[model samples]
Every structure is written in structure tokens, then in C-alpha cells.
Target: MEQLSNNYGEFAHFPEKVIQFGEGNFMRGFVDWQLQQMNKQGLFNGSAVVVQPISQGLGKMLKEQDYLYTVILEGLLDGKTVNTSEIISTVNRVLNPYEEWQEYLALAEDENLEIILSNTTEAGIAYDESDALNDTPPKSFPAKLTALLYKRYQLQKPGFTIIPCELIDRNGEKLLAIIQQYAEHWDLKADFKTWLTKENTFCCSLVDRIVPGYPRDRADELNEKHGYIDNLMVKAEPFMLWVIEGPQKIKEILPLQEAGLNVIVTDDMTPYRERKVHLLNGPHTAMVPLARLAGLETVEEVMLDADFSVFVDDLFARELIPMLDLPEAELAAYAEQIKERFKNPFVRHELSSIALNSVSKFQARLLPILLRFYDTKNSLPLGITAALAALIVSYLQEAGNDDAEVLALFAEAKELPTTEQVAFLLAQTKLWGQDLTEVAPLVDTVNDLVQKIHEVGTRAVIKEIHQQAE
Candidate 1:
């Protein structure tokens, strides 16, 4: 099979206008894929120069293919399963800063450059006090970015719009803070700091997509079908959302909305973030233990069970939706989209994969909704309380076998009744950040669910509750 490149198809080489900080799978599947859409719609007429953020990455492999690869999108769209493939030609080249420091810095001098995008992971935007500006490609992502920005500052060129897609909150602001910290640490000029602060536009962004890249299981089949060998082929769900908090002027510069993509440029991303976390992430965390207890391994399998499906629907509509401040219609629409994504047959999302560190996951994703529901309605949400019970039971059932903390939590409570067990767990302020016992009847509600699950099962309990929901 031939390699994937411009030679295989009619590909236009646009001026490099995007300097991207990561060449990983998410960037390829999400950002680059959208870039391809924008280019096709003539909304964006520019290519990206992908810079490998870490010391080792797919830069060489990407360069080998001339920065061209296929993005295979397979998932549920509307009411049908859709499978589509497109060759993303938006990436012009790939550079490893570790090996090509001068070339990476030279990107700052590009007259066509207008945006600096990155997805260097959650830990990528941290301040490393030891990172020196003179290091051959500084040890940290922020340091390297600082060096690049300083180079651009020296040129007296207009500031590029810096947007980071890291999972951290306010990623753009955090990255800029680290860069500024580097400036102060290295004793860079105040004028350069002024340029960094006054000239640059740092926009925080929220990106959502599930990109399960390099389908190794079907690589050979995919290659044979396409009659081409693509080592960089990426796979993702049909759902993609990019919510950017930026200046109003950004709407004029990056007109991605013209492509009909789910891109929202807003002054505040808080509501969107809260909506996503509660509607999508909260349910994901809630489903993990309950689904696992019900003998379901994958999200699709859980959805297949009529009882579990209805339980999920009720969890969203009756429990989660009422707590959020967003409009009911919009929330319902988004919730439906989330359910469809979960039902994507091509994506085998294991319940256990989402079960990792579930204690903290619940606190971060679901607890806010739980507390808010209590505060507003003066009562606990039954579905979420049951989920809390399921989580507690699931952890205890496999206690001492996984995390040491979980093991310790169960060291002395193994022989107690479910209610007593619930009491002990709820009293651990370190876990919930407060004694959940103070929430009035929440502890009892979880205890009842736990006891009922032990007596009957998750399926039966869910079926009963789902019927009530109807």
C-alpha cells in the first residue's frame, strides 16, 4: 500500500497560520479535523505547523507521511449510525522542538501566523521554577512557549491569539501566567512583559470529543480497504464541541462557525462547562459502578438494557436537568446528544475505564449538582443518591484490591451492615470535603439503596425506579 500524502490526492498548501503545540491524537482528530472542515468551506485558508511538545512524540512519523492522514469518524449522528472518512490536509509540517529548536522559534517570525493552539495535556501548563530560558528547548511546555513568545516579542510583530485546549480550567490564562512567571524568573525586560500582556490575546477554550486514535485492532483491514498505509490514521466519535472564550474580534479572525461546526465563541464559558460536566461527565461517573454491578462492561451494553437506558434518561431529565441553570430545552437537546454519543456502537467505552479514581471523579463531577439540588429543592435527588450508594458499594466490594486509600477505608467496615457502612463512609470529610451526614437524609437514602442492592440487585432497583420515572 502507498503512503498517505499530497501525491495521493489534490491537496492545496496554504500559508502556515497556526502554530500548534501538540501533534497527538486529540489534536489530529478534533482540531485538525475541524481545520480541514474550515478549509473546505473556505472559512479558513491556512495550514498548521504542528510542534511536538514533549521530548519524544509522533513528529517523525507525521513528517514521514507529509503531515497527511485520514480521520475516521464513526458514531451515532441524529438517529443513525454514520461512518465517514476524510483526509486532513490542514497540517503543513511537523517539528520537534527538542531536535529543531531554532526552527520552532523561527515560527514566531512567520508573517502569516495568527493563532497559537496547544493540547499539551493537563499537566502541560504548569510553572517550572527551574526551567531556564537558555535551555535547549526548555524542560517544560510553558518555558518553551515563553522562549517562542519572547522571540516573537523581539520581532515587534503583532501578538498571536493563544488558545490552549488543555483540560485545566482557564488554560489560556494559566499558560500565560506561567509564561509571565518565566519572564520574571529569567529577568526578561519589562517591555517584553508589556508586549506579552498588552499585545497578546490569550483565550481560554473548552474542547469536547472522544478520539480513540490508531485503531490497532483493525489497522490492517483499514489499510487494505483504503489501499494505503496510514500510520497516523485517527478515529473519533461524531460528536465534537469547541467552546472558546475570546475577544469579539476573534469571531472575525477565525470564522469556524461558518462551517456549521459546533463551535461557540463566548465571553463566558462557565455555563457551558457546568452544563457539560453535569450532563455528560456527571452521568458518566454515575453510570460506572451501577453498570458494572449490573454485569455490563461497556457503555453500549448498558444502553442496550431497557431498564438501564431508562434509568440513564431519568438520571438526566429528572435529576440532573432540574439542577442546572441553563434553559430546559437546550439542556434536553444536549442531554439527548450525550445519550446518542454513549450509544455509538463503534466506541466501546468500558465502564471500568471510567471507574478509575471514581471517588474523586464523583466529587468533582457530580457533587456540585448534588449539593445544588439539595440547596434549591431542600431535598436530595434520588437518582444521584442511588448512584452515590452504588459507588460506595462498588468500592467496598473490591476494597483492599485496588487503591490503598480505598483499602484503608474498608479495613474495619467489611463486616458491618450496609447502613453502618454508609455512615462510616459519609463521615470521611477528606473524601466528600464535608460530612455528608449533615445533608439530612442523604446518608439514609444512600444506605437504603445500598441495602436494597445487596438484597435484590442493581438491575431490579433500576427497573423499579425507571418505572416510577415513567
Candidate 2:
């Protein structure tokens, strides 16, 4: 029933060493939480100065709460359910550049600033030719950063380790490209560009966590239990991963690994990125339609249903795991964690939500796993083939805009028997991006699964296939 504040005597101020670009739910729940962990352990003796990238943001809210909030971590850790709470106090101050441009520029002059962390959404790392250096904090994320870095260059201060947590692939490189373009367009000195390139280290990082943000439904209950009013309280699952693509120098500068956090500082982030797509996204893509057709609403429901759960788990362990390059134990551990996440009671991940734009999602996530599984063993994976057939059935039942071309191909095969329809769908380059019929027995396998699904329904097909796998 006490108000959350630094005046409560539990929080302390450390030297400002980080400029975080967004005060959104994801950053607060993830990056800021990690920083709080490091500070608590005494491994990283620094605080983040929060920067609101846009004109309208959470600056006032953070300022009111003294940049203090609680992170409620709820999910399964190992095999046990966990619900824990911690007050985060690592954000020293929050500044909105639109309102306080001078203060924002002054941060670049702070010699102690070592890390520039940002998550201004996926569109944040874009190039805008119209953003002038003096246009009241600029328009785009990269432009604002360009102006800040130029100011830092003017002070002749050491460059910061810039790690962007944007969802874009090669985010750091793309950011660097935009900055370089800004320098060229602004006609800045050659030495300044060199300093931008040689002095600063831009790192591409992959951040994985589900921050649902501000548990509004349970706010009053949590407030009464904590005996305090936390307006900015954030909710997240227990799992978190931050993979930074960097060499030894970046590791030494941040040294977050010393805190024993789930931060991977490596030379290549490709494998980790692939592992995420294959193991997490791929399973979701492969299962969403099948689960939906079986009248399953949430992921929790699918996991609780005995027949569906076994099929989903077997799909991950037996089929998908063999396609990934990570160590067997590590992949298995992550797979188990993923299962726990899906079964999280606090999270209600609807199958229909996962089914959005599913054609591209399949192409990006499931298609690669299917192709790789075939290339590795010279045979089609049963689970993958079954899921593909289920998807075709679901789309036929209810089509989407992008599904039009594929639906037309399906219509062309309507006259043919179910057996020939499989081969026809396989050869449609517009659908699979390649003629999947080229792979041995894939057509026949998919054809048989299609007919079986039509005969027995989605749930019955799952039960039958799972029984066969057993």
C-alpha cells in the first residue's frame, strides 16, 4: 500500500553507462531487467539512461515512478512452475528527446556511456533522407542516432558499443549503413566517418522473450499483495535469451556474461537465429492449423489434450530436433522450455493468432525444416507431411489473400483424385517456392496424409499418427 519510489531506501544510483532508446514493454521487461540483475550481482556497475525515441512516449510515466517498476516473471523453470517478483531500479533517468533535445544530446558527451541499446521496433533501423540534424530530435531512429554520434564525435570521446535488439536480420550492420549514409548526406568530414567506423562497434543481437506488459487484469490483486502501487509493472515469462554477435572486445566492454545471465557473446549469431526459427517458430507454424482444426483454442489446450500433446512433442523431438545444428542436449533443453512456455497458464496464445499470414510464416519457418529433413535422410518427415496436409485442408476451408494463388492451384487439382492432388500441390512453384515433388516419395506421403485427414478429421488423424509413431 506504499507507493513505489527510490525514497523507499532500496534503490541506489550508479554511474550512467548505457543509453537505452526505447522505454517500451519489451525493453523494460527484458534489457532493463537484465541490467538490474547485473547491478544487483555487482558484476556490472552501471545504470541505463532511458531515451524515448518518439515524440509521445513513456517518459512522464517513468519519471513519476523514479524509473522503478516490478518485473513479474511467471512460467515454468526446469520442470517446476515459478511466479516471482523483483523490483528493477537500473534505469537512472528517462528523457524524451522531443521534449529535452539538449539533454538527449548531452548524453553522448557522457564519457562513461559504454553501451547504446535500442528496440524502437523493427522499422526503427531505417534510413530517412529527410531527417535533418537539427529537426527537433530528427525523424527516424538511425537519424537520431547519427546526430547523437556526431555530437559524441565533436567531444572526441570514445565510441560506445552499439547493440541493436531490433528484429531485423543483421540489425547492427543495417544501422551502421544508415549512419554512414547520414554522414555522407550531411557532408560531414572524412575523419568523422572514419571515427564512426573505426571507433564504434555495432553488434547484431538476437533477443528472445515474451513480455506481455502491464498485467492489467491482475493489477489490483498484484498491487494489494505487493503492498504498493506500481503503475509501470511489467509481466514476462521466465525464459530469456540475448545473443550478441561480437568478438572479444565487445564482450570485455559489456561483460554481462559475468553475471551468469543467459547472454551469448559470440562471433556468429546465425546458428542461434536458425535454431530459434527451426525449433520455436517452425513448430508453431506446423501445429497452428492442425490444432485449430481440432477445435483447440489456446496452446495450453493443445498441450493439455493428451493426443494432441504427444503429436506436438513428437513433432518437435523426433522430427524437428534432427534438423537443427545445435548440440543435442541443448536443443532438447530448449525444446522442453518451449513446451513449458506453450503450457503457461498466464499466457493464452490462440491458434488463430499464430495462423495470421501463415503462408509466409510457413515459407519462412516450416518450409526450411521440411526441406532440410528430406535432404538429410532422403525421406519426408511424417509430422511435417501431416502438418502440411492439415494446412492445405484448413486453407481450403477458409482462404486468405495470399492464399489465393495456392487456392487456385488447389482448384486446378479439385478434379483430380486426392492422390494426384498431392503431386499437383507439390509441383506448384508459387506455393512451396520450389517443386517439392522432386524430393523422393514426398508427394505420395503427403497424398496419403491428405486422404487420411479427410477420412478421420484433424484430431483423429493426430491420434492415429501418434499411435503409429508409438
* Worst lDDT 10-window in candidate 2: 398-407
Candidate 1 lDDT tens digits, 1-470: 78887678788778888999899888999988988888888888889999888877998888888888999989876667778888888999988888999998898898789899999765567677878988888878899999998999999888889889976567788888889889999999999999998988999998888776777778898899888999999988988889999888887778888889899999999898888878888888888888889899878888888888888888998889998898999999999888878888897676776676677668767888899989988888777887898988887887622344546777656777645888988888756768888888887788888988898988888877777667
Question: Could you give the C-alpha RMSD of every candidate to the true structure, in order shown?
Answer: 5.4, 6.6
In model 2, the clashing pairs are 1-227, 1-228
Per-residue alpha-carbon lDDT of model 2 for 1-470, expressed as tens digits? 67788775667679989999999988999998888888887778889998888888987888888889999999876667879989898889998888889998998888999799999865567677889987887888899899999999999999989999976568899999999999999898899999998999999988888676887778999999888899999988888889999877765667678877788989999989877867877788788878888788877898899888898889888888888888999999889878878888986556765675566567667788888887888867788788888887776666643444456776777768755777877788777668888887877777777788778877888777777878
Q: Model 1: runs farther than 4 Å from truth?
A: 76-81, 285-297, 306-311, 349-364, 370-470
- Top model by lDDT, which number? 1
lDDT at residue 449 of model 1 (Cα atoms) = 89
Error of 1 at 117 (Å): 1.3
Give the Å shift of residue 41 in candidate 1: 3.7
